[model samples]
Target: MAIEVNGKTIETDEEGYLINLAEWNEDIAKILAAEDELSITDNHWEVIKFLRDYYDEYQIAPAVRVLTKAIGKKLGPEKGNSKYLYELFPYGPAKQACRYAGLPKPTGCV
Candidate 1:
């Protein structure tokens, strides 16, 4: 599938994750979020940015448990738990957030 962004067509997978990670930018992210019916807020950006950084360093999308632990360590405990993350990405934090961040589906996610 493909999405039109600023007059350019960007590809995505059947599940809606970006086909080319390098094609991602803030505008693309906003479109992806809107597709998911989510309005990007500062808090959403925080998690999205964090996921991008993690993917950059690790070359992989983290699973939910690992995401929670890593987020706790870096972003603090209050924002690290499943409850908080779920509030931010109710579909599944790692999966949905990575999608917004233009990464592949996280391993172990159904």
Candidate 2:
């Protein structure tokens, strides 16, 4: 599938994850929010930005446990807990959130 944003096209896999991670930015985030049926809020954006930065720095997409732990360290305990993370991305924080963040699937997810 392809996601069109302001006349530019981004390719996605059958599951809606961006095929090319290089073609991502805040604009792509907006398109992903729409594709995922989410209303982009400050909190949601925070998580998305964090995911992108984490990928850039670590070169790996974190699993749910790692994500929660790391996010808790950076954001706060309340924001980084599994319950909170799951509330934000019910399909699995590492999976769904990474997809929206235009990142590759986290290793060991399946």
Best by lDDT: 1
Q: On residues 1-110, what C-alpha lDDT tens digit does candidate 2 reach at each position?
A: 99888799889998888899999877887778776787677888899889999999999999888999999999999998989888888788889889889998899887
- Name the regions of candidate 1 deviating beyond 4 angstroms: none
Worst 10 residues of 1 by lDDT: 29-38
The whole-model lDDT of each prediction reads 0.94, 0.87
**Count of clashes in candidate 2:** 0
* TM-score for each candidate, following the candidate numbering: 0.97, 0.91
Give the CA lDDT, 0 to 100, for residue 58 in model 1. 96
- Per-residue lDDT over 1-110 for candidate 1, one digit per residue giving the tens place of the 0 to 100 score: 99999999999999989999999999988998898888999999999999999999999999999999999999899999999999999999999999989999998788
RMSD of candidate 1 to the truth, in angstroms, is: 0.7
Error of 2 at 32 (Å): 2.1
**lDDT of prediction 1:** 0.94
